[model samples]
Target: MPSRSGPSDAPRWCVLGRVPGGGVARGRVAAVEVDAAGERSAPIPIATAELPAFVAARERSAPRWVWSDTPSWYPRLLEAGVRIERCHDLRLCHAILSRSEAVPDRGPLLAAARWEAGPGAGEGEPAESALFEIETPEDAPGAVPHDLDAALEEFDRQRAALAACVDPGRLGLLVAAESAGALVAAEMAAAGVPWDAAEHDRLLSAALGPRPARGAKPVRLLELAEEVRAALGDPRASLDSPPKLLRALRSAGIDVESTSRWELAEHEHPAIRPLLRYKKLSRLLTAKGWAWIDEWVRDGRYHPVYVPGGVVTGRWASSGGGALQLPRQLRPALRADPGWVLVSADVAQLEPRVLAAMAADGAMAAAGSGRDLYSGLVEQGIVGTRQEAKIAVLGAMYGSTTGDSGRLVPRLRRSFPAAMRLVDTAAAAGEQGGVVSTWLGRSSPRPGDEWEELQARASLPGATSRDESRARRAAREFGRFTRNFVVQGTAAEWALAWLAELRLRLARLPSPTSAESIAPARASGPAFERQPHLVFFLHDEVMVHAPEGQAAAVAAAVRESAEAAGRLLFGSAPVDFPLELRIGERALKE
Candidate 1:
């Protein structure tokens, strides 16, 4: 998504690519200027050594830089203390347009398999031996083409698809937001979250006792294991082996089908308490233990590799550092630099609010206005308690049809029929193997051929009862997936827009003046070492690392961006998206 340029107000674009016949850092860069009228200027060549300066100069015109992949292009510019205001990431846009149900003509994009390459493997690393050798695909197999010609062709295909797509405005916004997210992901990794190694170690020791010798259990884990063994009267039982543990529990008269926490809690055996505690500690030790610290943290920062749009619903995933699973117990380890503070915030009941806007459900919108949504439900007498309201809302979205959720869900349906009807229709379409789309045009993948075959076979003459059961189960399972996809996917779009808007806001803030009292965090690199920058982002939450004097401004930007995102997507909807915010030296839950 580039910036608007012509009479129709389309985005003006500057396309960049690698020039062949050059070596590594010695390569020449090729660029083209394209107007909204489909006219392109001759390729301009710039020396690799001078590319950063050229880009910095061109940015004054505020053209969206069109490039092959953000990971391949933006990191080098950021490392050089240069930042672009907007970009049209052809690789990411191709992915969205190729699979989008809104696109009337996806044939060209779908056939271009080269553009379907996964995200750049060496995200922060330079394309070749140096940052300027952008066309070298020797390392990344099946990578998106980085040569000038291929990139230009791919951009043309993408723009054509966008022109012919239904509701071009919405899809264009999604593609733009996704591209911005790519830039955000790279910048966050470069800055990293401020980490306190000593604090992390202290927390680890307090929870699991001191770190044990290599290949050995921690002291607390050993004690719990022995206690569980003693309770079962089996000194040699293998607690680590699930089958053996199950047999041991049976011998002790516990007789559980699995060692899962829920099943274990059902039995009152003496071994249960110690065993549960042991499993929890063991998970922490395994996932974020001493080894994790050695690998993920460096120079007082924890750098996680964020894969934007990694999930089918457009949610981000981490390839390294277990970022999505950072436990709350270790949150205190997220300490800001000496002169900086962390501004953290997360949306409250984001999906429900998104659902209210998508359905234009006036009653549901009124229920959640300026208060806790679940509490609002109780005040409106839609449910008897906060807990029931939560269960019913989750049930409605997740297609839950049994137990308390099932029983309470009908109450929500009656009170908010518009919201319920939206999901119910999506679920029915999914059951019949049809496509469903988010509010911003991100569509759900259709069921696979195997599923279609199973349903077809079950409908044929002389089909067995078992066949029909399997078909029904498969349909209902897909129904559940679609029921939640629209809400969750649209919520993810809202988050991306929020991140993009806030990033722009943070950039516009005046850089803090140098003072004797202020200390620099050199680890965050040139682009952010002395300025406020985003450090962390989960699905609905964000943490900005900013100078101590700028913390309040950062907090305001966080809230304001969320409001802008809601309006950008839903357009004057009455639904509210409130945030729970915190500002301090450390990221701690309130």
Candidate 2:
């Protein structure tokens, strides 16, 4: 089931393959362990020449489904053992497999080869699996030359050495599995360990060179010793992330040689363990999320992802496509169309700002100046220390514990009664599993009647076992609602303001001609005329793919939109709701 987009859930994905003019292929499945299955399975023609791609869209979300480029592929598919049920048509497919509860009438097709897999490959499956496809280069637009085909085949084999990891939950392997395996082989060979073809443990031990060994360990033989040969790249693997990750032990000296192994072994340094665990869980959730998104990409349709009215408040979303949950490790994979540039942007400390507005917490708002807002709080003497401030503020916003926020919340109650009382009420409601609604009609989901009865018993002295258990569960569910109701509701509002600003400001941005609506640019590239089109938005950020020439003005529009949104929400509250700006050939570095 879907969980909050946090460490609690595993990474999810709905990989989509799209082409302009609205043709597509979308898969909400992770083809980790079952890569060979998908690869070996016959391709079915979900869409035929006679019909639009939607024909197979119906069955896209069954136990497993596949859609080929054309219906003619269906004949080839039947030869491949995959069954085709009539319910697998487009409309029914979507109806059965909903992208969201409201958007139930949409089902995403599965990649044929990757069936029988999930958050992680289960028992009886190898730890690694992958899909290898040869796509005609958009720029080159041609098939691989005979000479390249051999190299490509070899590359795919080499990639399987580690890249085909079945367990995305294992952060260590997920980050650089294949790369690590190749490196380990090199390291072992360099150690001058005895040549292989002997016992697996003996060879690995010799390759690793003098490590303490456990007694009586089982070993699996490596496949494709030849695949282990291709690690001669100039730049070595990365042990560092540019924007400092939030942990120590990794802050400075890290060894890729060891990291690679740790990844393969699904282990990490003690200090790095939490990060790895979070990565695993995050991947699970992300994978699920993508499964929901994949419905759009199959058959290569240009269904710009829709951003209902833009912001949670009011704004139009992408009609069909936009990489929203792009992790720091995966930006490079998000490419743009042949002629289009990918405009990526982010809203810094968005939730905090919303919190500031919702609580009318002047001091918190002051702390959220234009910069790393968390760090900004460091400068304030509101708390005895920075760490204290961080924990306190975070606790207040997310209802977390084990921080200064936990300690200071009591003090905050004494100092800022209004803010403290408000969240406290929400918190109380949440603890009881009640969904506090926003100012708008969007109420959080409440517990059922059974839950209410359990809760009542839970409050009673000497409650029975089942009653106590039910009470605990109800409290947990309610807590989630109370904690998020304000932040999420206000966030939705801010999104609307930003969208509204963009919609209005784009008018003044500078449209050169009505024929094609040329957006301005900073330099020689495109620029907006007056208003730029509001192309996309992630949870708390927005992106406008406009002309390059009018970059600065468009940036200003974004800023103005944000400030206006702040004003619209807080009504000139004493707060610094600033929108930091970044622009470049690609998405600005976060």
Candidate 3:
């Protein structure tokens, strides 16, 4: 398989373009490629202002870039276009662009850009312009197949059409780079297929046939939401409450109250209004799709699709359906199979360890190794109370706006100057459109032009008042990045170590009793095993589908692996990355 651990080390994209200097206010830009069919092409890595801060924290020796010519179900955002920054090291850059995925459709058309020769035929300085000097496959060679230019031009259009086919069968090797919708890369030197644009268009139109006319308005969300008066049922009541659809989740061992807390913020976003407007979006793909969901539970073991690098910052996605989005109450859906148990654990305040290192916070580091850091914060007069300590520490580390963290942050700032400075600086960099890096090589990317403009103007001579307002604003902006980069990056390291250790343990186990087990469980159903078969990981969280016999062993391995990673990363995890965990079916504790 393709090492989809990450699409490209820098993040996959589909567009590359430039915003004119000092021009977030001005939107004029030149695009790298636009298919004859109207779709555009772009590079996968971010550029503009987003380049500096968003890079990931991988091993220092890992490659800087990886490309995907084949289609991927994974999410790779090339906002407007991802800028393919010329590798600062030419050899590396050359090797990367050489891939078919990086090949240009028309080899930089001079005619397309309105050409004008540079100052001199051989000026010492080459124009920054990316247009290439097309060398029409010439060399006093044999009378090659028909006009090479025409054949090549025809191929581009056809390639794009084939790409849009969306056939499940196109799931193979680096096939042809279909310009179908401008997302393909071709290797295996086969002659370009002959495809006339007009002909292909006709075929596509014919294949689609007459589309159905406009239909009824989409279903409403509230209509689909049949409210179950209480949370499933009261513990003391008889089986008195009639279980509503999907509400029976409480019976399956999920903690309904706790999971709801994780998604509380999801309801506040301005865009969520639309989802509320069109409620059916919450329902299945369609009513018929309901059967597909019913089967997941009936089978007894939930197999949430594991998507590698699913989040914008390189997290994975769940796909057989949105497994990550499941309500905490339905965790019982992920019950153990006959001879298995679930081994699940979550890292406590992962981003904080990263913050301590990034900020070089010795106090926080000391607490991380010596005790439960969050509790330590409460005991050490870091904040007024336990909850306040949690709020303040998280606010310091993550730059969040929720609860007392929002208020206590300013107070914590006085006590934790260095760490606070780091966050402030990162947020400043973010506002000023600069990159931020972790202990590892990953850096926060620059925001594109729009965000960049906001940062740039915030710095001009007339930008702010005597209060040092703009400067403060910019500092905090970048600080947001600085605050999270260290924690996020280090947490990632911990996860890698955890994953590696779990894999080793799993490999050592004897075959399960049931070979027919597609999804096996440990002893009984429901309780998660603490085993090493850690099959999945999300930022700061790990999920292990362990056989019942080895659940505890797996859990121990998960803890040890994390600590080991901390030791490897920073001499001793006690002072750098501290491992803390709790287990149960639901993802959160009430």
Best by TM-score: 1
For model 2, what is the alpha-carbon lDDT of residue 128? 26
Using lDDT as the measure, name the better of candidate 1 and candidate 3: 1
For every candidate structure, what is the RMSD over all alpha carbons to the true structure, in angstroms? 2.8, 20.8, 19.9
Candidate that would win on lDDT: 1
Kindly list the per-residue Cα lDDT of model 2 for residues 137-205, writing each as its tens digit: 121112111122222222233233223333222211111221211121112111111111122223333
lDDT string, candidate 3, 1-590, tens digits: 33424543322222222233344332222222323343434523334233222322221222212221111100122221221211111111121122222234323322222112111112222123223321111111221111223223323433443343344122111121111111110100011111122322232233232222344222333222222213334233222223432244345334344223233224343222332333224332332123334433232333344433333232334444455565443343344444555567776666666666556677776656556667777776777667777778777767876566788888767766777887777665665566664443334455566555655566677776633565566556566765576456445544544554555455456555444233432223221122224434556666665555556666777777676656545554335444455454323434
Angstrom error of the Cα, residue 101, model 3: value is 24
Stretches off by above 4 angstroms in model 3 are: 1-303, 318-320, 400-406, 455-479, 510-532, 576-590
Arrange candidates, best lDDT first: 1, 3, 2
Model 2, global lDDT: 0.40
Tell me the TM-score of each prediction against the true structure: 0.95, 0.46, 0.48
Off by more than 4 A, model 2 = 1-304, 307-323, 333-345, 383-388, 402-416, 432-435, 459-462, 469-473, 513-531
Give the range of the ten consecutive residues with the poorest summed lDDT in model 2: 188-197
Task: Give the candidates in order of TM-score, highest first.
Answer: 1, 3, 2
For each candidate in the order shown, give its overall lDDT on alpha carbons.
0.87, 0.40, 0.40
